[model samples]
Target: MANTHEMTVPVTRPTAARQPHPSGRRLTAHLASVADDLTALWQRLEDDPAVAFHQGRAWVEAWREATGANLCLVTLEQDGAAVAMLPLEIKRSCGLSIARFAGTAFSNENTGLLDSVRLADLAPVTADELALTLSQAGLGADVVLFDKLTPATAADAPYSALPKVFHQNPSFQLPLFADFSAVLAQINGKRRRKKMRVSERRLEAMGGYRHLIGEDDALALRLLETFFRQKALRFAAQGLPDVFADPAVRTFLRILATDRDANGRAALELHGLELAGGDHEGEIIAVSGLTLKHGHVTCQFGSINDVIAADVSAGELLFYRMIERAALAGHKLFDFGVGDQSYKRSWCPQRTELVDCYVPLNLKGRLAAPLIAGMIRLKRVIKTSPGLHRLATWLRGLPVRRQKAAAEPD
Candidate 1:
């Protein structure tokens, strides 16, 4: 069984005196002084349909434990009732104080918590007011960087009202059907079917294989560790920086994988492919980590023992099985997340556009904004062009050479 952390917070205003806005709607923003304060606001936000698992209390708590950053919760109030909340983290990045959405390293999608009824009637000016208030909330941040936001999320009054730079990062999603066959029928062309059949045959020759869904926290943690090791190998082979190499990131993932939600389901689900008999018999050859919420199953990361299961395409096979499992479990959508991979396109027909918002809080932030925007634009260009991307990968793969030290004069 996974560990459960029940969050409980008392609803109260900040200790500092709050002045009424000119429009008569009191806007009070403060750093959540304690975990309980955040828990209370998070519980209230849970009632709103717009809040995703990424912005939930559990996810934020995991992130806080992994990265010890200051938590700032900004709330907008009307008639002494909170209408919206923005959960942010303040940290120093690139020599400047910055505020960013919490859990950016692991969250696939993010949005602010908004009161549904109020959101429906929110005016453009009011949205702008909320954004302005957050910028000047005295969080000691020079700028705000909001990333991985979809249009539906950004449409929330506060985000929509902000004057900021935008960048496009597209994500993919597949609308699932009642059965696996129905889902397969839509994407399983002759070539794909042939490949899948070949993979199945190859795996069968290797003494059979089984797809295993972890049922306990211990098993889940073990599988997660295997995934991290496999991912590290993959990253090294491809000359890419291993984000999971950081111990903090691993700790955060473990917390997520071992935490249970209200329904007794682990917040992070782990699945693996195990060989029944072979040189690597009883070992998990491939693994996938995912999260299920709001009728959607989002694939977070996956890894395979390419050296041992390359012929069978274990990673893809595992995904096929997971998709079937998700459909059988009544998930309405399978999201591949934000990436432009040929494999993702083969499965997900729907594309969601994401945007990044950069808000300058002071004169220093204004001066640094363009540099940051330019870097993002350059990365987008490199990621989109096949030749450039390949070249970049090759360059990254080249080992760094150290120059010989000069000999001392005789």
Candidate 2:
């Protein structure tokens, strides 16, 4: 038998009063709000190690501050002990409600932050129970979006069985390696070393490369600014909003740079490397800000120069050094986060899948259900077809000429 943590929760109908839909057939939940109870549930699950950073408390706070979202927690408890939790934020736009797990849109991975042990047997029961409970609590969102949920989460999730639920998009995650040699082997040691040699020779021909790990407040700010500029350039070239366009992004980065654990130590360790030589001139070539916590390090944010003077391999080198430093720092896992880019796969052997699902409650749900269903189907069509995805990527690259032109002045 699995532990209590692994038990599936049984679902029950909403006991609260509900108003009849216009169709006079369907019903909506009418239970009094239970935000307090739900918050406690969120805290309990967040305190666990199984949850990823996106679903963690810090991210929730950061997202609320950055997006000004209305956050609410929901949970199911038996005998006063919480069994499951969902931290959802509702956004109203265009007269429609968008419901999603707190901090999900920007961050990768949006699983319910469930206790695997407690849910082992309850996988079948979890979703239904959650739906009923949420309806009772007046979760009035017309659409609920869950992004980048690990595959296992879907398999174990309670409501994934709904036939209308469909998957259209997918992302990838890379594993962090503790062994330097292992990483080298994966990326083609001989070829990579040769490239490194060439870069070194070219760099030497100029002058020499300089590496600087930021120290103190001012220097950290400068390095972070450089990273933002470079990252924005990359996004503009690709025709996407540099998420860091908002000052909040910078504020968050700086907080990580200067923050520390409860014991009062450096919370952020940001690296800034400068490369200069004959015509090369001194310029920021690579910058990476890694968050360290509980023996784990995440490549939180980073950017590299695309200029000719810089080496394509510098970013890899910086990552290599980060791995070494992480080991030295006694960290165990390094997460590359979500995305299925080829570079990520070069270093990661492990892959996790994300999932989304839906259920309807009233006449409005019945009416909107088809649109949601169509979107899900269309998404699948686009994702499974390589040609379509390529076309999308290409189209995404076109409108960014303005951003690219703006960056050119840099």
Global lDDT of each model? 0.73, 0.60
Q: Which candidate's lDDT is highest?
A: 1
Off by over 4 Å in 2: 1-44, 121-128, 157-178, 204-206, 210-217, 255-257, 263-269, 276-282, 291-297, 327-332, 373-377, 380-386, 397-410
lDDT of 2 by residue, 1-410 (tens): 10111112232232234332233222122222344444655666866765766676566655666666687665544334445566678877666676778756556556665766655533243334445556676787765555555555655644444333434544432334456555456446576567667766766776877776776667777888899899988886677766788876667556666655466444556787677665656687889876544555666677898875554567766776666666555566666665545555555544444455665545565467567767767866776678988887777666665656777865
- For model 1, how does the per-residue alpha-carbon lDDT over 295-373 read when each residue is reduced to its tens digit? 7788988899978877788888888888888888888999888777877877776777676666667778878877877
How much is 124 displaced in model 1, in angstroms?
A: 2.3
TM-score for each model: 0.86, 0.75
Clash number for candidate 1: 0
Residue 144 accuracy (lDDT) in model 1 = 79
